[model samples]
Target: MSLPTTTKEYFWKELGSLANLSFRESKLPPLKSHEVLVKIHAVSLQYRDLVIGLGQYPANVRDQLVACSDMAGEVILAGKDAGSEWKPGDRVSANFCADHIAGETTLEIQQTAHGGPIHGVLTQYKSFRPHSLVRIPEHLSYEEASTLPCAALTAYNALMGPVPVKSGDTVLILGTGGVSIHGLQFALASGAKVIVTSSSDEKLKIATKLGAQHVINYNKTPEWQEKILEITGGRGVDHILDVVGALDQTLKAIRIGGWIHTIGFLNGTAADVSLGNLMKVCYIRGVNIGSVAQFKDMNRLLASHPEVTRPVVDKVFAFEETLQAYNYLQSQAHVGKVVIKVV
Candidate 1:
């Protein structure tokens, strides 16, 4: 049994944007049988959090829903069956799926994403389960580790799953956003050729510095997918990280039997139909943010990958400047992850 040291706890609450989030004091819930009291060190921003705050992301879990996904923290109080890997002082990262503890990511387990259907992490002290908290890799600071639970892990599942990519495989990464950035590292470290595209040549240049062998400024060539086919000598890419979303341009972008991870809708949500092009080019698979089991699996592979020296942080904002970070993300000016520092 644990006792509270303070009568009130600080949490962020926003019923809507007109009333911007404010700090509220609340009492802690009783700890569950397999939960730990975690003192959160950092909270990560996500598109879904902004959507939820704007009343765009709907959830049955009404009001008082905290608004952040990824977090890093230390265990404070451990439950009886919380197990051996976690202790009072262990530094850890929480998975987006608070319920998917480990092993295979079955469909049921994969459905529990944070900051929407479940309570979010924008608080100082949160009750975490052993299933949700994974120990941090030794090389990363809490801030760096905090960004991986969703984006990096999703890219991992897209590239490093049961399928093995070899020295000469080709991957086409669309855009310079978080998913594409992580995808670039995975492709480079796995000995695959990477072709990265961006609307800005300047951003493409930066991605090239990050090990992209070929860069296409889509702004320069509107028929950029044709440029892709030309660069690959009409063979087309073996894999395409189509974070481009519902765009039919990506449908024309891959070789037959090649795989495409349909992760986000950054380009456009509703694009023209091209069933023939999609069938002729390749296969498409939708990706969610991924699971804790997947996170551990990917971490083991990534710990050894030379290309992933660190998550490329375009900028870091102070904890209080989280809204600014969100606005910057809205601007789409960065080539990689924009982080917030919380302590």
Candidate 2:
């Protein structure tokens, strides 16, 4: 738990690329009264990290910002005030937006997001305030815990926050990415019927094994909405976790008064918001990554029910292969979260 004089870290040194990222040795800063130093063991890859690396994300990050948001590690050092709350060797996960500890997210809170508008935890060691870290569940390994901060938390917010999915209700999750897979798990745990859409029939089979009640191959069935309505006996699903953000299709898939939780834009970001389409649903909630309070709540659930709530890590790269991990995520071949092992 002793501090090192210098730590190795990766940074986004230029815009519009991830090809030439280089590691630099930096001296550790003195810990503040409210801070603890983390020896990051693992960091998970998120799509937003890709955009931030390209300098296309909206957050006003530093010129050479560290390039990731989700990380899990040991609390290696704790300052005076933090000592009571955190101790050396405690496993912890970093919050996505450090200042958004609880309550609703705001523009100011969004700017404090890690990996963008702030230095991230893709380093051997990083320091953070107690409020910005959550102790991970004992059952989860550092790699598994690393997957929660962004993808899992967003999925939890979509399913459990704002409008909770109820038993006997049908929930639709688009694609087999990290968030969508987690959504499928939460929906099934809530006793709701799950319908997952994927372009790959193989991935669809995997989704079925993960407890998705129905699977749609959107590539073969161009009009997946029709299939969804058919599956529900023309009633449509009660909740839709639309990670792809297929606007027209999302508008078509929900039933009257059903909730559509828009979590990501893997398909596309911009779409013409048709007023007619908007009127069809009761709510179209936009889900951010979620607050630290939500992350703690999720960890509690994961602790109690490890079978249903654990993270599904698709692949792990060595810390030196961080760039390749991002490339793999870009290929969209991963079924769940991709991680970088930094221990």
Candidate 3:
């Protein structure tokens, strides 16, 4: 028996630019037996949000769809059969792929991603299946927890998945963006040395403070791969988190028998790599975020080691200023996650 009836939400009215987003108020749907109504407190922005806003994502680009995947909220109401685990006042966050509870990912599960193809949590309130929501760490505020689902989970999966990173191995992170920053934190937690690259000396200095053992200025050293080889004594890095999709540089920078996780395309979408380069690495795995089970695993790790895994939020915006947040993201001035606080 909840008293709140109407909710305010942002919708992507057309497939074009950020200007197409529309705001409106709607009546909250009747909660299903297995549903929990969440009062969204904060949402985080991702690069994909920009692509989705620009109508560039390959799938699930629908008119009037909600436009964000990461959010943290409190459970305001729960249906009779919602489950014993949930109650009013419980803080939670939604998984990136709502249907991926456990096991390997499938096309069906991938298609159910929030934001682009599905209605997202960019609203004041949203109804979610209990299985799709997980409890947030008690030590983290709603804003901090909102940065996890996509960026943090992707980094965690890259480090802890099939090819697990280990102590003493060196990891090369491409930039100072959300995913890379999270990767740097996880790599440090795994007891691995980190090498982060950026065009800015300032961001590199920040990365150094965040525990990166070495920072390279890619703009200053256009042939940054050569510098990586020089730094590693020609052995190259043990793992390369290829956020830039810079295949040529990645090929040159990864040591033989190392792993490379392809996570983003900030530099370019297409590239040619030598067959010789392919033979040297363990594998080049393409990382989408992760499953709900993986999300839980990440949360467990975060709870145990809060110091090593705090999300770096660059700026906070009011809920009405989502467009400004998007513009800020487009400017690429932020070093970490951009967040929106929804009161």
Best by lDDT: 3
Model 1 agreement with the true structure over 3-99: per-residue lDDT tens digits: 5543222223655561465555567787787888887777666665656666655454446666678877778888888877777888888888887
Q: Which candidate is the best by TM-score?
A: 3
Per-model TM against the reference: 0.89, 0.96, 0.97
Report how far residue 185 has shifted in candidate 2, in Å. 1.0
* Runs with alpha carbons beyond 4 Å of true place in candidate 3: none
Candidate 3 RMSD to the real structure: 1.3
Worst 10 residues of 3 by lDDT: 264-273
The stretch of ten residues in a row with the least summed lDDT in candidate 1 is 3-12
> Which portions of model 1 show Cα errors greater than 4 Å?
1-19, 58-61, 102-111, 267-281, 306-309
The deviation in Å at residue 147 for candidate 2 is: 0.4
- What is candidate 2's CA lDDT for residue 337? 92
